[model samples]
Target: MQASLFSGLPDRRERSTAHKYLAFVYCTNKEWARCDAAFDAAFDARPSFALEEYELQNTPWRDAYVKAQGKRGWQCSRPLAGQGSNNRPGQDSANPLVFSLNSTIITAITPLLPAAGGHSMALDGGSPGAFGARRPMRTENNVQLRVSPWANVTLNGKRLGVTPPLTEIKLPPGSHTIDFSNPGFETVRKTLKVEPEQSITITHDFDAR
Candidate 1:
């Protein structure tokens, strides 16, 4: 893990950033205690560390970030880095060592929207089990994917393309199945239950798997 590696690095700033990301990882998985711990580690490593304003607004782990600060008996000072409204994490390419990727962005499943610059591909196959079962057209439910190293995706035996995958996946309230497979990693199959207007985020990291 990059977090572990960064923990031992000579630079405290890098370590803090790594732990910040690790917190998001635990947050996405709903591991509350570990999430708080990772944030604590970040602040402990570099007290000057802070997140940008946009991060607090758009990221899925904002709740966890708040809880982490609450556990520390304090609140974070906003945008301590002095980054402007137009600034973003990867916008600066001046330093080769400065690339930071946030893997905790929640991904949504789709019926495959061609408008999102992704050409929707439908694989003709067997009947779509309960997933394809008829229900009200109200797309009141959503399925979000968080798969690492990516995988060939399938929903109820109907292909949904691969991870780093197609977006805008909307479905009616019900149960569905999705399968994730990679060349050497273990294939992951997930059964999702969606209620009206409910969103479920599935997290999978194919490590030694």
Candidate 2:
């Protein structure tokens, strides 16, 4: 719905800064063609903006723009001053026009974090009431668990699985107990809060018993 709606926004269509974000939305949807086009438009909007201008750049948009470029075999010029640092990227204040509480509608965009081995981490959830809670859902969110070595996993009291990496599991919103255990290592446990329509990550490294 958002992509379709944004597709009609004059700013997005006319190659405004919005094109940078539209590219992100497209990337999230894995719409490579649209993503590339949106990014290309962004570059055309500011072709001379150099990486050294990182300090003055809109970081999220710039980072996503560069990532898209790299993935597409397009070369990006790195800022000479800070060649190898993982220093934070530039930041931009959210536009008040687009992010006011009084507004009937709003959109929040989260960047995709690519993991090694060609996997990507992304979270997508619909409107608050879209996923009905008629009689109370069995689970309202997905949790991604990462544990060192393989360990037995459990939710509440039921065993779920043993995992070197547990991609995801569903659980009700609010608080829940997670348990992990592996031979020769101390058992690990945690209490977590799960928000509806969001992804939570839990990482545990067991200490040798």
Candidate 3:
């Protein structure tokens, strides 16, 4: 399934995330070379990629990550005044989960969700979210979406326009409402539980009940 998720990912940053995840899996399987290659691919996708502080200090893939960074003659950059922070599980911050586009998915939010405190860049290990300077981060979860046909997406009370292009949204951790509507099909509203560092899939098939 992880391999399948990488098929049509259009964003370079998202691609780096996929590579990093694959690297972790490879290392867990003891596929040393593949693990290193995956990390390298991640770097190629995004040079600014880095492991979170927790990812650097702990986790089974730490050594592999270090080795990968060493090959490039690099070190983790320090977090600017208010730019970096920890995003551990059960926390209110996380890396956005990515969804690759395909024929079946009309509107899917795959690139990731808003950062917890600030806009965060997706990274290899736990996301020590890199806050975005422009927008304020208000959510701690990333939601992956899949809607068939086409639909007008609405989250909370705001209209998210139509699908086929809407790929990112931000929301706080907790329960939120999402509405999917198409011309001939009935509107479907779903309530979801969002958590930090956890990826949730909200799929709606207008053709089905």
TM-score per model over all chains: 0.40, 0.32, 0.36
lDDT of 1 by residue, 1-209 (tens): 54566568678886786677666555544456776788878888887767766456433356567665766677767742433222123344232111122322223333221122211122113543322223334443355555553456677787655443333355556677778765434577777655564545455666532
Each candidate's root-mean-square deviation in Å? Answer: 14.0, 18.2, 16.0
Please identify which of the two predictions, 1 or 3, would achieve the higher TM-score against the true structure: 1
Backbone N/Cα/C clashes per model: 5, 0, 2
Angstrom error at residue 5, model 1 = 3.1
lDDT of 3 by residue, 96-200 (tens): 323333322124343322111211223224433422122223343255455543356777766654443344554555777888765444678877555555444
lDDT agreement with native, every candidate:
0.53, 0.46, 0.53
TM-score of 2: 0.32
Residue 7 in candidate 1 has what lDDT?
Answer: 68
Q: What does candidate 2's lDDT look like per residue over 1-209, in tens digits?
A: 32344345455334344455455445434456776677766666556423334321333334455655575566666552432221122523442111111211112212223232311223234444222222333233256555543457676776654343233455656777878765434677777665665555566544323
Error in Å for residue 189 of model 2: 0.5
**What 10-residue stretch in candidate 3 is worst by lDDT?**
112-121
TM-score-based ranking? 1, 3, 2
